[model samples]
Target: MASWAEVEADAPEFAAAVRRLLDAHRHKTLATLRRDGSPRISGTEAQFRDGELWFGGMWLSRKALDLRRDPRFALHSASVDPDDDDPAAWPGDAKLSGRVEEITDPARVSEVNKDAPPGPSHLFRADITEVVLTKVGSPADHLLIQWWREGKGLRVFKRT
Candidate 1:
C-alpha cells in the first residue's frame, strides 16, 4: 500500500488529475466489506490534509464498525452527469482502494475534529493500493481509463 504522497511523488500528472476529481466534490461513495463479505456502500466525506487522505464517521456508526472489522475499502469520487454530445466536457470520475489505518491518538483526533460538530468520531488515514480515473475520450463512445498501483506507476486502458 502507498500513501497519497507516494502516488503524487511517483506520478505527478496522474496524481494531479485524481486530486482534481476528488476535490471537485465534497462527498464520496465508500464501499466496505460487511461481515458476510458483501459490499456496503456508504456516503462519506474525505479531506486531504497534512499530505494524507483522511476520513471518518460518527462514533459507532455501521460503516465505522465495518472498517474496524475489515480495513479494506474502496472510495469513489462523486460524479456529475456529462453532456452526451460533448464527451470532452465530462468532469471525469475517480476511485481509490486501500486499507485504512484508524487514528486513535487523542491529540490527533482532536486536531481532526477541531472544525467538526461536537461529537465522538472515528478517524482513519488511507493507505492506497490503487487509484483509477475514467474519462470520456475524443470519441463519444470511448473512455480513457488510467490507473496507478503501488510500484506499477501509471497505466492506461481505453475501451469503447
Candidate 2:
C-alpha cells in the first residue's frame, strides 16, 4: 500500500487525473465489508490532507464500525453522465481501494475535525492498493480505462 503522495511521486500523470476526478465532487460511495462478510455501500466524504487520503464518520456508525473491524475499503468518486453527443466532454469517474488506519490521537483527530460540526467522530487515513479511472473515448463506441496498483505502475485498457 502507498500514500497518495507516494502515488503522485511514482506516477504523476495518473495521480493527477485521479485527483481531478476526485476533486470534481464532494461526496463518494464507500464500500466496506460487513461483519458477515457482505458488502455495505454508504455515502462518504474524503479529504486529501497531509499527503494522505482521510475519511471519518460519526462515532460508532455502521461504516465506522466496519472499518474498525476490517480496514479494507473501496471508494468510488461521484459520477457524471456523458454528453452522448460529445464524449470528450465527459469528465470521467474514479475509484480507489485501500486499507485504513484508524486515527486515535486526539490532537490529530481535532485537527481533522476543525472544519467539521462539533461532535465525537471516527477518523482514518488510507493506504491505497489500487486506483482506477474510466472515461468515454472520443470515438463514442469505446471506453478508456486506466488503473494503477502497487508495484505495477499504470496500465490502460479499452472496451469497445
Candidate 3:
C-alpha cells in the first residue's frame, strides 16, 4: 500500500490532477465491504490532509461499522455530466482503492482535523493501492485513462 504522499512523490502532476477532481465537488461515493462480502456504497467526503487521504463518518454509521470490520474501500469523486456539444471540455473523473486504518488516538485525530467531532466518530487514513483518472481526449476522438498502482508507478493509455 502507498500513502497519498507517496503517490504525490512518485507522480506529482498526476496526483495533482486527481486531487483537483476529488475536491471539485462536495460529496463523493464510498464503497465498503459488507459482511457478506458484497459492496455497500455510501455518500461521504474525503480530504487530503497531512499528506494522506482522510475520510470519516458520523458515530455508529453503517459505513463506519463496515470499515471497522473490513478496512478495504474504494472512493469515487463526484462526477458531472458533460454537455453533449462540448464533451472534450469535461474535466473527467477520479477514483481510488485502498485499505484504511482506524485513527483512535485523540491527539492524532485532533492533529489531522481540528473540527473532528467532539463525540464518537470513525476516522481513517487510506493506504492506497491504486488510483485512476479518466477523461475524454482534447479532440474528443478518444478516451484517456491514467492510472497508478503501488510499486508500478504511473501509466496512461488512450482508446477510441
**Regions more than 4 Å wrong, model 1:** none
Q: What is the C-alpha lDDT of each candidate?
A: 0.92, 0.92, 0.94
lDDT tens digits, residue span 1-160, model 1: 8989999999999999999999888899999999999999999999888778999998999899999999999999999999867878897999999999999998998887577777688999999999999999876678999999998899999998
lDDT of 2 by residue, 1-160 (tens): 8999989998899899999888889999999999999999999999998889999988899999999999999999999887767987898999999999999998999887688778789999999999999988877788899989988988999999
Q: How close is candidate 1 to the true structure, as a TM-score?
A: 0.96
Least well predicted 10-residue stretch by lDDT in candidate 3: 113-122
Better of 2 and 3 by lDDT: 3
Off by over 4 Å in 3: none
What CA root-mean-square deviation does each model show from the true structure? 1.0, 1.0, 1.0
**Cα lDDT of model 3 by residue, 6-110, tens digit:** 999999999999999999998999999999999999999788997999999998899999999999999999999987999999999999999999999978877
Clashing residue pairs found in predicted model 2:
none
